[model samples]
Each structure stands twice: as C-alpha cells, then as structure tokens.
Target: MNREQPDPPAGGDRIRQTAVRAGGDVIGKKVEHHHPAGPVTALHALPTPPAGFTGRDALLEELLAAVDPTTGADRAGVVVSAVAGMGGVGKTALALAVGAAARQRGWFCAELFVDLRGHTPGAQPVDANAALDTLLRALGVDVEKIPPALEERAAFYRSALAALSDRDEHRRPVLVVADNAAAVEQVRPLLPGPGGHRLLVTSRSTLHSLAGARRIDVDVLTPKAAVALLAAILGADDSRSGRTEELAEVARWCGYLPLALEISAALLVRAPHLDPARLARRLAQEGRRLERLDDGERTVRAVFDLSVQRLTPGQARVFALLGVNPGPDIATEAAAVLTGLEAEEAEEVLQDLAGARLLTSHPGGRWSMHDLLTDHARHHLTHHTGTEVEAARRRLLDHYTRLTADAAIHLQALPGEAVPATFTGTADALAWLDTEFPNLSAAAYAAQHAGHTDIAVALPLDLGVHLDRRRRFDELISLSTLARDTARTTGRTKAEAAAWNNLGAALAGVRRFQEAIEAHTTARTLYQQTGDRHREANAVNSLGAAFLEARRFEEAVQAYTTARTLHQESGDRRREAAAVNSLGLALAGVRRFEEAVQVHTTARALFREAGDRHGEAMALDSLGTGPGGVG
Candidate 1:
C-alpha cells in the first residue's frame, strides 16, 4: 500500500503529435519524435474513444443534444459544455465519447483538443498563455507569428474560428475539447467565437465560474453499468452468467469508478485464473483497496494523488481529518471540532473541497468523502501530514460525548422536569439524537477500538435511556455490550456494574428474562462489594422486574422485599413505592390475596407521600385486580 510512484505526467507528455486525421478521427500516429509546435494538416486530433466503451446513454444524449443543434439557427455564443467530477469518474471518457459521436454526425468539419494538465503530477498546469500558443499553432498559425500577450492570442484565436465560420460557403463548425482544465482562466481564453462552433471541457473541479456552460456532473457508474463494463473488458459471455453476482461484488469494491474498474479488469486479464470472488475478497480490505486497484502502469491512488497535490495546505489538513470520521458523513460542527477550526472556517474549507470534487456536499451542510478517497486521505494522514490522528479522534469522540450527555439529561427527565440549557426542550434533544445517532454509534466503537476506555464506557451509558425510551432494545443491547466489555478490560468495576444494569434492562426489554436476571444479579453483587447502597437497590429493583417478567412470582416477591428495604435505607421514597407496588403484584401472582391487598394499600400511601400520581393510580388498579378483591 505504500508504493509511492509519482502519477504519470498528463497532457504534455501524453500528447501524440504525429497522429493523423482520417474520416474525422485520429486514425494512427508514428512513434517517431515530433516538435512540440508541429504543423497540423488535419484539424481532427480527438483520441480514439476507448474500446468497448459502455453506458452513459442518457448523459451522452444530453451532451450531444446540447452540442449539436436540431435546427440551422445560430447559437447566442459558442456552445460550451463542461463535464466535471472526481478523478477516475470517467469525465475524460465521456467527453471523448461525445467528441467521437459529434464527429460521426458530421456536425463539425474540423476538431481540436488540448490537455491543460491542470492536476498532473510532477508538472505545473499548462499556463494560459502557453496553452494559447499551443491552440494557435494547432489552428495553422506559425509559432513565430502567434501573438505574445494572452489577450492578443485569445482575440486572434477567436477570430480564426470566426473567420472559418464567416465563410459564404464551406463554413466550418469546429469543436474544441479542452481536457483537464483546473481553472476558469485556462478555459476562458480558449472559447471559440460565435459561429456554429463549440467548446467541451473536462475537469475534476465543478468549474461553476464558466458562464452559461452546460455542466454535466459524472459520478461513478451504476452497479449494472459497472458490471457490464467489467464484463466487456473481461470479454465474458453468456457462459459466465453465474459470475454476475461475483462481478457485481467486485464492482462495489471498486466504488464502481471507471478507472478502478478498468484496472481491475486488467489484473484479471493478466492473471487469467484470478476469479472475481478472490479479487473481491482482496479488495474488501479497506487498507488495501486502493493498493489492489493498481496494474503497474496506472493506479487509483495515483489519480487521487494528483487531485490532492492541487489542494491548499489548510484544505489538505481538513481532507485528512475527514478520513478518520467513522460515520457515513460528518456535520459542519463535528468537522469544526475535528479540525480545530471555527465552524464558519471549516464550512468554507468544506465547500472548497466539494468544489474541487475531493468531498461530496449533502443537504444541511454535511460532507462525505468517497470510499476510496477516504482511504487515500487516511493514508495521507498517516504518512504525509503532520496532524496527529489520535488527537483528532479524541476531539471527535469528546465532542460526541458532550452532546450525548446533554441529550441524555433531556431523555431521562420526568414530566414537567426542567430542560437543560444546552437544548431548548425534550424535542430538540431527541431530534439531535435522532440525527446524530449513527455518528454517535460509530464514535463509540472508534473509542473502544482506540482504547479511549472512559469515553467508550460513558457514551453507551449516556445513550441507554434514549434507546430504551425509543424501544430500540437491539441497539441498546449492542451499546451495553460494548460498554460492559470495554469496562471489564480496564477493570473499571463501577462502570462495569452500571453497564450490566443497562444490559439487564435491554434484555428484559426483549423478554430475555433469564439472561436479564443473571446480568442484574451480577450488577447487584458488584454494587454491594463497592458499598453503593443506592445503585445496589437499583440493581435489585431491575432483578425483581426480570423475575416478574419470567413469572417466578415467589422469587420476585423475595427480591422486591429486600429491594424495598434497600430503597428505604437509601432514602429513595419513589423507588421504595415502586418496590412496594411490584411486591403486591408478586403476592397476587402467588395467590396470597389478603397480603396482596394490604401491601397494595401501603404502596398507595407511599406513592401519595412521594407525589407519584402515576404510581398511585397503578397501585389502586392492583388493589381492585388482586385475588378476592371487590371484583
């Protein structure tokens, strides 16, 4: 995974000058050396559309319809279309496909192409003035005769296209495809003048500054399309239909990006016996996904490196911070904490990263990195950057811990309880928890894995009340287990006892009463050993509830009787009243009718003293329903 070769130099080093045009396409080129400013007898210089190119049917139609008009009416200006996306998302392939289609339609008599080298490695982006020199020469103007200044060269370049279009007969409709432009400045000067001509640009950036340009955003291929493309590259036929599912899995591992897909196909092609299943298993390892996508000549990491190379230092740090975000996406506030930036500053940096296609922005100002890109950023964080990964993770976990504590306060509050100042009310706290639950869950796991034992134990404990209130017992069980195991590892006896109590409640929630009783018993014993009478009383009360659910009424009665005494000793009047009510229910379950009524009466008096109207109503109901009562 650490093989660090520089990305292949783009544009300048890859251009083929000896390539000749035939039938409106670059048919062939001599490998012999040619000058940089060589003469072009034919204007067609579009690279051959990739072999077996597949998909993008709808997008292809959209681009073609925009570039080639149905009527003979003149356009207001040159029809400029820009295809933008993250690296390896097939921007160049789609643009080249459009160029080939336009050529076949005979919409243009001549074509010109340039590689602006905007994000190339080990080389600077082609300068605007230098790009003009290249374009001017391709238009048949001698290098010595071309203007020196950028504006003069641009004016002359536009007029040359205008002159070709202004002809009375044999007027030319030229297509100038500017590939790999990093900025608007590199493209602004290259727009052909008004005629029926057009300019198509492909960039990793959104290039939103291009006025009136029809921007097409290319994302990863869909699973069906990715599989089809992979099959095409592998030349699989109907005989291999059984491998469709395996191939689809490989496509997912590749993130369905075209460049990665092509390299995966190449690996299979070279090995011949490496099946899709084995390849998928290798790719499933996140640490090695980008590594497995390489085929000697081209790598997904190399493509991504070029994009990262273009980012500012501040942006690069933020990008690395995002790598360790354990959830599907991160909010602006969380990102602010992770990067040690103000929310406003972090948001601006996030927007800039989105514009560069390094991150994807979602509604409500959240941002997410693509799977492969996240791996790359983590690699950068580990090897290339000065940022401490553990420190960043701690900040993130602490941020989530504080928010969860605030939410828990509101969740556990009784009716008419004062809401915390951190949240407006119960609804606000609940809403925050609902939105941040996935992130919170991930952060808890991250803390456990990173050995942040205290936060790991505290977070799940804080989430217990909320999960139980929502009846999400499955999630509650999971967090409780994490808290229990994590605490056991650190020998935090008090924390482990608390976690067992929570686990007991969650198990009872799902009717696993035997397991619930065992957990609560362990918690009670631990509490007794620690000399905590209040928590011990709480654990006994939970154990009583589990026994009652399991219909062990005699055992429930004994547990509640002891629990009632513990609560009284601890001066917990409301819990004492609760224990009395449960004791009455157990008495009735064991057919001790008169004792049940007498206990219910005492429970009613206790609830009245404690101002627990809900408990009093429950006790009155129990009195009526007891054996041999008024009913």
Candidate 2:
C-alpha cells in the first residue's frame, strides 16, 4: 500500500483545474436554507384547580357538559357558560373544576386562562383591546404582527383558531377559561365563533346581556354539604371529637357559605385541640364574625371589598347606609328614606346591588344583605366615607326622627291638638311604630354615640310613649341616658331639659322613684333657666308624680301648684287641667278632702273646656276614688 504508484496521466491537470474552479464558485456565493415553524403542541395557562373542591356536583356536571368537545359538532357555536355569584361563592372554583375535568378527559390541546381583573381590588378591569392582544400573543401571534384594534384582534384570534382546526395534526379543541370578567364587551372580543372550542367565564355579575352565553348562578352551599366540607377540611381526627353538633353550629354561623366554612375549618386545623364549640361561640358574635373569618391573606372582608369597589358612588352610598340600617331587611321605600333617594331611583340602585350579588331580593320588593356583607359595608363606611358618613348618618337619623315623631302625634295626640299630617289612622301609626321599634332604638343609640345631639334628644321624646305602652323599659332607660349625656354635651338647654324629663320618665318606669325625682328636678331647673314655661310646667308635673310615689305629700302638692300656675300663664289649658288633677291627688294624700274636692271641680271644668273626654273621665274617677284613682 505504501509503494508509490506511477504518476497519473495528464488528465489529472484538467481534474485539478475543474476542482479549483468549483471551490472558487462555492466560496464566492452564499448558501440559502429554509426550515418551517414547529406547531404549538400544548398550552397550560390556567390556574391550578382548587384543592378538595367540595359540593356543587350538579353545577359542576352542568358546566362540564356545557364545554365538552364531543358535543361541539352538534352545536352551532362555541359553548359559553357564565358562572356568576356573590364574591366568595366559588364561581372561579366551579369553572376551574370543570376546566380540570376537561383537561383530564383530553378535551383540548390549547388551553388559556386570563384573569380579567373585573372586580379585583386596586386594579382596573382589563381593556378589551388589551385582553385581545394577550389572547393573540397566547395563540403564538408575534406582538408586532398582531392587530392593534379590538375588531382586528378578534378576527385574527378566530382565524388562528380556524387555522388550528384545519390542520389535521394540530386540530384539537381549545378551552378558554376567563376568570373575573367585568363586563360583556370585555369578554366579547375574546370569545371564539362556532368551532370545536369552548369558553367558561366567571364574574360577580350574571352578564345576562352576553348573547349565546348560558348563565349559572352559584349560590352558597347547602347545610349538609357545608358541614361535609368542614368535615373534609378537618380530616378524621378533629371531626370525630363528639363535636358534630358544634360543627353544624359553626357552619350555620358561617351562613353555610363555602368561603366562610373553609376559613373556619382552617382555624380548627391549625389548633388541633381547639374545641369546635369554642369557635362556634366565637362566631356567634356578629361584630367579631368577620374578624374570625380572616386568615391573613384571604379574608371575607377582602373578598367583599372587591365587589364594593365596583359600585357607583350612589350605589356605594346606599350600601353604606344599609350597613347602618338596623333592620334584617329593607323595603325599597325605607331605603329611599335612608338615602334620601326617590323610591324608584333607590329601587334601581338596590336592583343593581342585587345583580352584583351584594344584596339579595326577596319576594316582597325588599332587599337583604348577607350577614358578612353587611359587616363589610359598615367597615367601608367607617374607613372610606369619612365626613360623608356623618352627614349620611344625620340624614338617616333625621328621616327616622321625623317619621317617628309624626307617628307619635297620630297615635297619642289629644283630641283638638294640631299634629303632623301623617298616618291613615291610629292603627296604622301603631303598626309602623311596632315594626320600627328596634330600629328606632338602634338609631337613637347610634346617633348619641356619634355625637348627633339633636337626633339623640329628639328620638326618645318621640319614641317614649310607645316604649312605655309596650313596657320596653330597658330600651327606654338606655336611650334616655344617652340622650341626657348628648344634650348636656351640646349645651342645648331646652334639649337638656327634654332629655332629663325623658330620663325621669324611664327611671319611674323601672320603679327608681328617687332617681326619677332627681332627674325631674334637674329638668325643671333647666326648663326654668331656658324661659320655657310650658316644658317647665311639664317637668314640675312629673316631679310631683315622683314625689307622690315616694309618699312626700307636701313636696308633691307644692310641685303641682307651681306646675298649675306656669301652665295657666303659658295658656296651656289642657296641661293646666292635668296639673289641677294632680294637685287634687296631692291634697288627698295629706287628708285635705275639702281642698281636694274644690281642686277636682276646677280640673273637671278645664278638661271639659279643652274637649278632652279622657281627661274629664279621669278627673271624675279621681273625685269618686280619692288619691289612688289619679295614677
């Protein structure tokens, strides 16, 4: 092999020259090569599905059936199901559940998830054009090539889906999960036309106007299901502690709402020895319920705040007032009164709230908020409304005060007395008072605490008679004390006198006659200083009643005489009649029968002149039965 062979023939020279020429040509020109773009095999952009998702079996099944690709060939367009509910009602959870199930079933090759940030706190909703750009980019469209306008972007998205559908190798169905969609238009451009694809949307609103979208309203879990969820979260060891009843109570206190249940369960899971009964008792307090439901990052209040942030200013104001409202539910007219809105306008606002699931509508044209939502609204009112809160509260108090004062005049006004034009009859007045009794008390307390002195002073004066008639002495005592303090702080002498007078009445109702006398005496001095002869006369009359109750006859007679003289000077014949009747009782208390009889005769004449048949009857009965008859 190593031996040199004979030199090649002269043909080698031509071969070398040809080879050199080929090398020079290759070196002088560039080579061009082409490769095709690879297909997008899979996309997993959805959030991980919630863990241990419990209940909602029916809703889940319906959602799964809605987006199942096998049925796409039989349908006209891509199936769209809108999952809507109040915040924390598990709207996103249901959508994720269906999405996970679909992925497991191999329903789609291209998957997409976008948080529209519709009602997210501290974030504006995604713009439709921007959202479309996101979808185009997600579909492998280059940023520069993607259309800038919404319509073009939408067209491009559809074309992309069409191209994918036409490719036999990549013609797998697509699944899009749009979470927290704020508005219809925000979602419109993102939806695909008729094809082997589906979209599942979640929002606080129903998005009812979105054409061809099936809506599923996700409500709170059923009681059995809620308890089961709590148990599932607690695991075996904690759930079987003979505290099943307490667990049920815990769920009930959570309103059987899934979000609340999970938060409550988390607390128990952290403290393995913590009694379920203890947690139940803790949640029993409404003021503390929302606080207890917080777990640092995911709070019930935080969940509710997002929905509240989306409200219009008027709706937000109405919601704040609803928080301050003491009733379990509100009639539209009542809400109108609370917010100073026209009834129709207020109803529209309430319906908007109901549509947003911040409020729920009952059959009787009334609206109610969930217990936790009410707390959240109040929280917002306390922190965000600022000076407007004071003004709004004043308006609420003024509304209730005027209506209640009118009601009292209708129910308790003496014949021939001028009263506010209100109520169809005494029965109507009584019914209104009975229905508003608790609210009236709550308003009075709230006003006093918030330093609205006028409202506090006026409230008990209007409500006292009804409360006395109903034997609601506890509320009377509480309201009157607060009124006294508030009036004194504001230095309104007439209001202070009125507050003391009401306080005396409440004290007497509870059989605290000594304190009642002291209160009445204070009232008399304040009235005299203010030069209010009529109220001074009223105060002296109350002072006499308290004296008589304490068996101080001489003091009682002296008090009644002073009241009678003042009433006569003030030209209040009706009250003069009342004072004269009381003087007769004091006279009988000291065994002065002759003077008592003369006083009684004078009282009878005054009562007749005043057209007070009831006062006349009382005076006649006193004449027949002596001192005991007056009371």
True-vs-predicted CA distance for residue 160, candidate 2, Å: 78
The digit string of per-residue lDDT tens for model 1 on 327-417 reads 7678999999999899999999998777555776777778876555677788788754444778888999999999887776665454555
Candidate 1, which ten residues in sequence have the lowest lDDT sum? 1-10
Per-candidate Cα lDDT values, in order, are 0.70, 0.66
Tell me how many residue pairs clash in candidate 1: 0
| lDDT for predicted candidate 1 compared with the true structure | 0.70
What TM-score does structure 2 among the candidates reach? 0.52
- Listed per candidate, the RMSD to the true structure in angstroms reads 28.2, 37.8
Q: Considering every candidate listed, which one attains the maximal lDDT?
A: 1
Find the 10 residues in a row with the least total lDDT in model 2: 15-24
- State how far residue 62 of model 1 sits from its true place (Å): 20
